[model samples]
Target: MKNYLRLLTHVLLISWCACNPCTRVESVDISAGVLLENGSVIYDGLEYPKSTWYEELADELVKRYGCPCIGRVCMWKCCGPGQTPFNGSCLDTGLAEVNPFNPPVYRGREPSNITAYGTFFYMHGHPCIDSYLVDTADVNEELFIQENGTLMEVAIGGTQWHLPTGYCVDMKYHNNSVAPRLVAAVCFPEENVSTDDSPLLYIAYAVGLLLSVPFLLATFLVYAMIPELRNLHGMCLMAYCAGLIVAFPFLAYLKLHVGRIGVAMTGCLVVAFIVYYAFQTSFFWLNVMCFDIWRTFSGYRGGSTNKRRDNKRFCLYAIYAWGVPAILTACTAGMQFSDNLPSHIVVPGFGSRRCWFVNWLSEFVYFFTPVLFLVVSNVIFFSVTAHRIRSIRQETAILKGAESSRSDKLKKDKQRYALYLKLFMVMGVNWTVELISFAVGGSNWYWIVVDISNIALGVVIFFIFVWKKKVRGLVQKRFRHMLGMPPVATDSRTGRWTTSSAPTEDTRISADETAIRLKDMH
Candidate 1:
C-alpha cells in the first residue's frame, strides 16, 4: 500500500511539471539590461522604452567602436549622412544645382571623370537625382517621349541632358529670363519603351499584315502562270508583290520578337537588312512601273514586241530596282557598324533599339528621305503621263474616222493608265498617312485605322490587278491546259470568255506574242 502511494505521488509530480513548463527557467546574463514582455528594457531598476533604449545604445556603440547599433545589433556603417550605399561605395544623394546664367558646371565630377558602369555611369545632376547617366555623345539634343513610348529629339535651347534609365526631364529655358527648374520627370524602362505595345494593337497589327499574305501570293502566282501577263508592266507588278511578300512576314516577325533581339543579335540585324532592302526594292519597282508607263505614253517605242529587247529592258530595270536598295542597305550596315563616323552625321541604329530604325531622326535620314524622293519622282511621272493621256485622247477623238485599230489601242492604253493611277493612289495615300502619323508621334485611333489599311495593301493590289473577268478566264484556261482540255474561247473585243464559237488562240503562245500583248486583258 505504501509503495503504491509513492508511485501515485511521482505521477502527480510529472503531470504538474508537464502542465507548468515555464515554471523552470534557464539563467542568462542581464547585467546590461533586461527586456520585459512589454518590450521595455530595464537597467538600474529603471524601465526605458525599447526605442529610447535602442537609440541610446546605438549612439554609445557608434561613439565607442565607430559602428552603428540598431535594436542592440552592431552593424558596419558604410555610408555617411546624406548619402546612400551603392555599387560598393557611398553615393551622394544630392543633385547638382546650377544657375543657367552661370557657366555649365558639375557639382561633383564631370561625366568623363566618373567611372563607367558598363555603358552607363552616374553624375551629380538635378532632376535625374542619382539615376544612371547617358553619354552625351549617345543621344541627340533634347529628349521627349511619344505616346507609343518612343524617345524623341527636340531642340530646347541646345541644352540637353540624358539619363540611361529611360527617365526624361524637361529642361526648357528661355535664356536668362527663366530660372533653372525641372519641368517634368518621367521614368520608363528603355527596353519596355521599345518593345511594349498594347496587346490589342499588336494583335491587330500582326493579323492585318498576315491577312495580306495569301492575296499577295495569289497575285504573284497568277502573274507567273499566265504567259499573256508577262509584259514589262506585269513583270514590274510581280516584282513589287514579291517584295511585299518577303517584307511583310519579316516585319511581323521582327515586331513579335523585338524584346528578345538585343543590340548585338546578328539574326535581328540580318532580318532588319532584308526587310529594309525588300521595302526599298518594292518602292523602286513601283517607280519603275510609273516611269515605264510614262515612257510608253510619251511615244518611246523602246518597249517593242521584240523578246530580246524587252528582256534587256527588264534586266536594266532589275538592276536599278534591286541594285540601288542593295547599295543603300550596305551603306546602312556600314554606318551601323562604323565607329569612325563623325558625331554630327547620325548613323543608322538598326538592331540597337528594336531591329529597325532607332529614332525618328535616324529613320527620317536613312529610310524616309529616300522614300520621299521616290514618291516625288513617281508623282512627276504620273503628272506627265496624265497630260500625255489627255493629248492622246484628244487626238484619238479627232481621228476617230481613220481606223478601229487606233480606237482599240487608245482604249487599252487608258485601261493601263487607269490601273497604274489606282495603284499609285493606293500606295501613295497609305504612305502619306503613315508619314503623317509618324510625324505626329502617337497611336491615335485614326492612325491605327490607317495602319490596318496599310497592312491590307496586298488585298488592294490583288483586287486592282487580278480580280477581273479576264484574269479569271486566264486562270481557267491555264487550269484546263494543265488538265489536257481545250482552251476556252475569249471574245476578241471584250477579252472575256464566251460560249460563242469564236476563233481562239492556243494557250502556248510564243515569247514574242506574249511581249506584244502589253494590255492587261480586262
Candidate 2:
C-alpha cells in the first residue's frame, strides 16, 4: 500500500506537469471606437449615453451589412418589411442581415448634424449591404462596429458591425492605448475553449487499463500457478509493476472526470512500479541465468529447484533496479535538466516512455543497466545450451551415435531467442511510434499510429503465448483457476489431483509442487 501511494505521487507529478490547459489568449488594450448600446460613440472626447448623431449613423449600417457565414443570412430585407432588431438597436446584433436593396444613408449629407462621435458618407452607403464600412478603418485595427458587442478587426473582406456592451474581440494585437477601460463581464476563467475532447485519448486510456489488470493477474498467476513467473527476475517483475502503476492514471480518467484526484493518482503509481520492477527483474534474471551456466547448467534443474529459497537475491535485484528511477524521478521532478530535454508539456519526439532504464539523465540506469542484463542473460542462456551441445557431442562420439538431441536443442534455443527479441521489440516499436507522434505534427495521425501499435502489442503477446504449446497449456489452467473453476490435472498418474469444489488441506503445496512439474510434458 505504501509502495502504491509512492507510485501514485510520481504519476500525478509527471502528468500534472504535462497535460494542463493554462495558456490563455492574451487580450491587449486598444484605442478603438466604442459605439455603445445607447448609440453613443465614446471616441476621443465624447462620453454621452445616447447621442442622436451616432444613432442615425448606426441605423444606416443596420440597413446595409450582409451575413458573412451563411453569406445570404444578411441583415438585409428582400422586401420592405425589415426584420425587427432584438433590442430595437443595431448594438444588439453585431453583423446581421439587412435590406440589401436599400441605399445606405450618411448623416454628413446633412453635415450640420455631424459631431465628433461619428462622420457619415456624403449620401450613399458602402457597397456591403449591412456593414458600417468606415473609410477611416485601418488594417487589423480594433473597430467597434455592429456584428456582436465586441470590437473586431475592420477589413474590406472581413467586417464587424455591432458595438458596445461586451465589446467584440478578434486576432488583432495592440501596443498601447489611452482609451478608458471596458473590462470583462466576469472574474472567473473558462474551460475547454473548444469542444473537442479527443475521444481516441479516452479510448487509449481505457484499452491500456483493461489489458493491464487481467494481464498483471495472469502474470502474477504465472508465479502462483507456474514457477516460471516467480522465477522471473525481480527487476523485470518490478518493471512490469511500474508499467501497471503508470497505466493507472490512464485507467482512472473516467474517475478523474468525477473529481477524484486520488483515484487518478493510482494510475500513475502503476506505471512507476512496473518500471521499477522491470529493472530489478532484468538484472536478477541475468544473474540467475549467469549463475546457472557457471554452475554448469545441471540443465537449470538445481536452480529451478531452489526457486523460492532465492527470494532474498531477487528482492535485492528488484530494489536496485526499481529504486534508482524512483530516486531520480523524485529528486529531479521540479528541476530543469537540459534545454534539449523536452518537458512534460512538450513530449520528446525521440524519447522513450519506458525510459527509467534509458532516459536523458537515467542513462546509467537505462543504458548500461538493461544492456548488462540483456547481454549477460543471452550469454548465460547460450552458454548453458552450448555446454549441453558439447556434452552431447562427446557422448554421441563415444557411443558412435548421432547428436540429434544437441541439434534439436540448439534449434529450439534459436527460436526462443528470436521470440524474446521480438517481444523486446514491442516496447521499442511502441515508444518509437510515440516519439514520431510528438513530431510529424502533434496531430491525431501520429497518435493514431502510436495507439494502434500499442493495442497490437497485447495481441502479439497473446498469439505468441498461444502458439507456444507449453505457455498455452499453462495460460489455460491459470485462467481457469482465476475464474474459480475446478483445477485440471496435468499428471495422469498422480491421483492426488482432485476436482472438489471445496478447499483442500495442502492445496497450496501440491499446486506449487506440480507447476514446472509439467515442463517435461510441454
Candidate 3:
C-alpha cells in the first residue's frame, strides 16, 4: 500500500511539474490601440480597410496611442462590461478581462524604467475608465496621476491584487473625452501582463471527459451485469457514471462550439441546464457514496446487519441526488425565461453562445452552493468514517489474540486502510480541490489540479473497481462460457478452479485430488 501511494504521489508530482507553466506569472505586453494614417486604419502594422463608423473610431483611437495592434483591445472594453463583443459590443474588451480578475490593460511601458502609460476613454455616458494592474513588488508606492485635469496621488494599497501575490490598481478617469486621458504609473515588472491559452485547458478538459466515457460505460456494465456487484455501493457507482455519461457529451459540445455566433438562445439554455443537472447529479451521487460507506462502517462497528437498510436508504438518496438537481436546474431555466433579468444574468456565456451560468450570484445561489453543501457534509461523514475504521482495526487486532505479533496485525490492517483511501479518492477528495478552485476564482494552481483530477475520474473508477483480480476472473469465466469451453478443474477444499488434464471421479476435482493422492501414498 505504501508503494502504491508513493507511485500515485510521484505521478501527481510529475503532472504538476508539467502543468507548472500554466501557473507561472507570465509577463507579456498586451496592447490594444487603433492607429490611423492617411485616412486609413493601421491594424497589425498595416493599413486596414475602412468600414463601420465604430471601426473608424477605433482606428482613430489607435492612432492617438500610436499602437498598430487593433487586436490588443481588451475584451471588456468592447463588451461594455458583463458582455462579449460578439453580443453587440466592441471587440476590444476580450483581452482586457481574459483572466478571472480582469487585470488592467496598459499601453507601452518604458523599457529603461519602471514607468508605463495607460489610456482610458469615457464615452456613451460611461462613468470612468478603470485599469487593474497586477502587483509585482512589496514596496509601498505612490503614483502621480491627472484625473480630469487635476493631479492626484493614487495610492497603491498592496503588493498583490486579487491573488495574494499580486496587486491591483484602480485608476478612475473623470468623464471627459475632449482631452486624451493618460494615466502614467510606475510598475516594477515594467509591464503588468498575463498570457493564457485557455483554449488548451478547455481542450485538455474535453479530452479527459471523452476518454472517461468508455471507461464509465464499462464500469456501468460491470456493475449491472455482475449480480454480486449489484449492491448499494455498485448502485452509487453506476449512478455516478450514468451522470457523467449524460454530462460529458454536452460539455464537449460546448467546448467545441464555445464562440460560435447566433446560437439559439433556447438551445444554449437547454444544453446548460442538461450539463448542470448531470454534473450535479454526479456530485451528489458521490456524496451518497460517502454517506453509504459511513453507514456501513458504523453499522459493522455496532454489530448490526442491515441488509434491508440499503434498499430503504437508496430510495432516499436517489430522491435527493437526482430530484434536487432537477428542481434547481428547472428553477434556473425558469429564471432565464423571466423578463426581469438581463439575458446574460440568466444564461452565462450567452454572448459567447456557450451555455453556462454567467451571473456569479445566480450560480452561487443555484449550483455551486448546493454542491458545496454536499461536499461539506461529505467531509464530516468522512471524518466519522475514518474514526470508525480506526476503532474497527484496533478491535480486530485485539480479537486476533496477543499471540499474534502487532506487526502482523498492522500488515493486515494495511489492506483495509488502502481500501478506505481509494474510496476517499474516488468519491469526494477531488471536489474539495474544486471548491478551492472556486475560492481562487479558477485562476490558480488549484484549478489545474481540479481539471486534471475531475477529468480522470472515470479512469480512476475503472482501475480501482473494474480492473481488479476478481473482476477479471468473472469476465474470463463469462467469456469462456460464451465460447463453449468446458469448466476448468476445481479444488473441492478451496472451491477454486484450476488447470488439470487427468480425469477422476469428479473431473473438476482431479487437479487437487491427484496431488492429494500422491502425497498420501508418499
RMSD of each: 15.8, 19.7, 17.2
Off by over 4 Å in 3: 1-198, 261-264, 301-309, 341-353, 359-361, 397-423, 442-446, 486-522
Task: Single out the weakest 10-residue window by summed lDDT for candidate 1.
Answer: 62-71
Give per-residue CA lDDT, model 2, range 149-194, as digits (tens).
1233332223333322212111111212321121111110012113
Residue 358 deviation, candidate 1, in Å? 1.3
Candidates in order have lDDT scores of 0.61, 0.37, 0.51
- Where does model 2 exceed 4 Å of error? 1-200, 233-242, 245-313, 334-412, 439-441, 466-468, 475-522
Ranking by lDDT: 1, 3, 2
What tens-digit string does per-residue lDDT give for candidate 3 at 364-413? 66677887788788878778877876876766667567534343434423
lDDT of 2 at 250: 41
Q: Candidate 1: where is the Cα deviation over 4 Å?
A: 1-197, 300-304, 444-446, 491-519
Estimate the TM-score of every prediction.
0.65, 0.40, 0.54
